[model samples]
Structures are given as C-alpha cells and as structure tokens.
Target: MSTNKVIHALYNDDDILMDAVKKVRAEHHHIEEVFTPFPVHGLDKALGLAPTRLAITAFLYGITGTAVSTWLTWYTMIADWPQDIGGKPSFSWLENMPAFVPILFELTVFFAAHLMVITFFMRSRLWPFKEAENPDPRTTDDHFLMEIPVEGNEDELKALLESTGAVEINVVEKH
Candidate 1:
C-alpha cells in the first residue's frame, strides 16, 4: 500500500489564512482542505469551489409541498366532505382558496426547511457516529489548518508556508 504525504499548516488568524490561501493558489499548489474555528466569508470563492445548488433543491421541495397541500385540502374540504362552515359551501378549491392559504404557506416552509437540511447532510456525507476528519483539535478552538498534498517539492512548499506566517507546520503520511 502506498502512503500519501501531506503538509498540515496551522495559522492563528483568519486574515493570515486567507492571504496564505491566495498565495498558495497563485503558486499553483492544490489545497486539499481548510479547517477553521468559524465560518470565513468568501473562502469558498477563494477556494475556487462552484456555487451550491441547495437553493434550487429547496425551491423544488417547496413546490412539492405546495402541490401536496393543495391536493390534500381539495380532497378533504371539497371532494371528500364539503362543509358549510363560514356560510360558504362552494365545494370548489378555487372558491375556497383563501381558507387554505395558511396551510399552503405552512407546508411549503416545513418541507423546504426539513428537506434542505437532509439534502445538506447527505451531500456532505455526514452521518451519525462517523469519525471526525479534522487533523488538529486546535483548529476547532482558535487555530486554522490548511491541508496540502506533498508533490515531491517538500523544501519549496515548506519555505512557502513558512513565509505565509504559518504558526506551525507538520508533514504526515496518510494511508
């Protein structure tokens, strides 16, 4: 079995991390991943990642909820048992749409929120009892860590990282 070598660079501040990321990219080095204590705005764009499609999925889920709620309201209030509550027994969904507005809005929000969370978890490959992938616990507190695969230029990479204000750097082998 071949072992892959990677360099883990730790930084103290987010600003330094961002500058280091830009410099690493400028040198055509591929960054495998970055870990931070909190979200850093514009990091995804700096990493050259594509825009997420979660919003599109959310909209579709909302539409599905709307359709389901519409059908349910029609079947129960109009087709199955027409009730003459509020002095209106039109028995038509269109005529009684105002009454179903609340249900439609509520179900739409519910489905969108729930399904979006599920989709995010699935897409991220997150599951219960999964082992953590973080290389350093310090990154979860106040440090930032950047993982980069070593491509045979260890000395050059080390120099580059050191110049970028990395607080610490380590080389590790992964199976």
Candidate 2:
C-alpha cells in the first residue's frame, strides 16, 4: 500500500495555529490532523469540522442505565427478596421507589460516564499499548502540530504555512 505525503507545520502558539488552520481551509486545503498539548478553544469550529455525535450517544447510554437500574431493582427487591425494604414491609415497587432514587441517580451517572469514556476511546482508536502517531513530541509539551495533505502543491502549502507564522515546516513521506 502507498502512504500519503503531508506537510507538517509546527506552531509555538495556539493563536498562530488557529490562524494557519483558517488560512489553509480558506485556500481549499484539507488538514489531516492537529496536535496540541492542551485543548484549543473553538479550534474545531476554526477547522471547519463537523460537530460530534457523542452527546447523542451519551443520551442513549443514560436511558440504558435507567432501564437497567429499574429492572435490577425490581428483580432484587420485589421479586426475590419481597421482605423489609426501607425499614418497612414494601408491597409494591412504586411504594419503595423513593428509597431507590439515590441508587437510580448513581447508576445512571455511572453508566453514562463509564460508557461515554469507553465509546470515546473506541471511536478515537485509542487503546492500550498503541504507538503514538504524533509527528513531533513537542506538541505534547508546548508546541502545536498541523498536518496538511500534499497533492503536488508542496511549495504553495509551505509558503502559506510560513505566512501564517509556522515555526518549523517539514515535508513528510509516511508509510
């Protein structure tokens, strides 16, 4: 398989990186990726990327959590152990629902939190023992890295990047 060629531009400041992204998109160039030491506010909008669907998935996970909590509570308290609940003889699940409110809240939050994290990791292709794909390690410290795909316009891209205050530029041939 053939690998893609891309221009990797390094920026010392987030402001410069943001401007470079806007300029690159304005010129109809696609940015493959950007790496930063910390989250850059509104950087996603500047990059013209689509909004994430994680929130929708989180909603579904929350519903699942509520459902599971309801079912487990019913099976454990009302079905098998139809005895003392909340220091009283509970005859129905609805009567004992107030006591289970805290459990319901905790389980809902737990499932949503745990599942959302797992989903994010799976969607981002992050897993244990994976090698880093960052072109430069400095991005993890202070620098920001932007990768632009090369389609035989290396000189033009380099010039544009340099004009946007890129500190370092490299034409990388990756496999």
Candidate 3:
C-alpha cells in the first residue's frame, strides 16, 4: 500500500485563511480542501470552483411539481369525479381551476420543497449513520483548516504556511 503525505494548516480567522489561500494559489500549490466553521463568502471563487447546478435542479423540480398538481387537479375534478355543487357543474377544468387554486399551489410547493430536500441530500451523498469526514474537530467549532498535498517540499510548504500566519501546521501521512 502507498501512503500520501499532506500538510494541514490551521488558521484562527477566516479572513486570514482567505488570504493564505490566495497566496498559496499564487505560488502554484494545489489546495486539497478547506474546512471552515461557517460558510465563507467568495471562498469558492477564490478556490476556482465551478458554479453549482442545484438551482437548475430546483427549477426543474418545481416545474415537475406544477405539472403533477395540474394533472391531479384535472383527473380528480374534471375526469374522474364530476360533481355538481352550488348549481355549478364541474364540466371543464379551466372553468373550475379557480376553485382548485389552493390545492394546486399547496401541492406544487409541497412537492418542490420535499423533493428538493431529498435531491440535495442525495446529491451531497449524505445519509443517516454516515461517518463524519472532518479532518479536524476544531474546524467545526472556531477554526479553519487548509489541507494541501505534499510533493517532497515539506519544508517549503511549511515555511509558506507559517508565513501566511498559520496558527498550527502539521504534516501527516494519509492512507
């Protein structure tokens, strides 16, 4: 089996972490991962990550919800069970659409919200009883951690990380 060496640099502040990331990239170092206590604005841009497609998925899911609700309303009110209430006969779906507005809107929102959540969970590969992938527990509380793979330049990388104001730096072997 082969083992890979990586440098883990810990920072106390997000702003400092951001600057360090920029400097690391400027020096042509590839950052493996960054762990932050909270979401850092513009971090993805700084890391050169591509934009996510979750919004597109959400829009498609919402359209699907609207279609399902429309079909359900038409099938139940106009096709399956036609009722005459208050001297008005349910003969056409368009004419009876105003009365089914609440159901349509409710089901549309319900399906979109529920399905979006499920889709997010599935896309993120999250599931119940899954083990945590955190490298440093302190990152979950108040610290920021940047992981960089070592390429036989531990000293140079460590010096650079120290110059970037890393509070703690460690070189560890990852299997």
- On TM-score, the leading prediction is 1
What is candidate 3's lDDT per residue for 110-129, written digit by digit as tens? Answer: 87788889988998789989
Most lDDT-accurate candidate? 1
Estimate every model's Cα lDDT from 0 to 1: 0.94, 0.91, 0.92
Where in model 2 is the C-alpha error above 4 Å?
85-87
Off by over 4 Å in 1: none
Higher-ranked by TM-score: 1 or 2: 1
User: Each candidate's root-mean-square deviation in Å?
Assistant: 1.1, 1.3, 1.4
Clashes of 3: 0
Better structure of 1 and 3 per TM-score: 1
lDDT per residue as tens, model 2, 68-127: 998888788888778784485566889888877887888899899999999999999999
- Over all chains combined, what TM-score does candidate 2 have? 0.95
lDDT per residue for candidate 1 within 101-172, as digits (tens), equals: 999999999999999999998999898888998899999999999999998988999999999999999999
What is the TM-score of each predicted model, taking all chains together? 0.96, 0.95, 0.94
Against the true structure, candidate 1 reaches a TM-score of 0.96
Rank order by lDDT, top first? Answer: 1, 3, 2
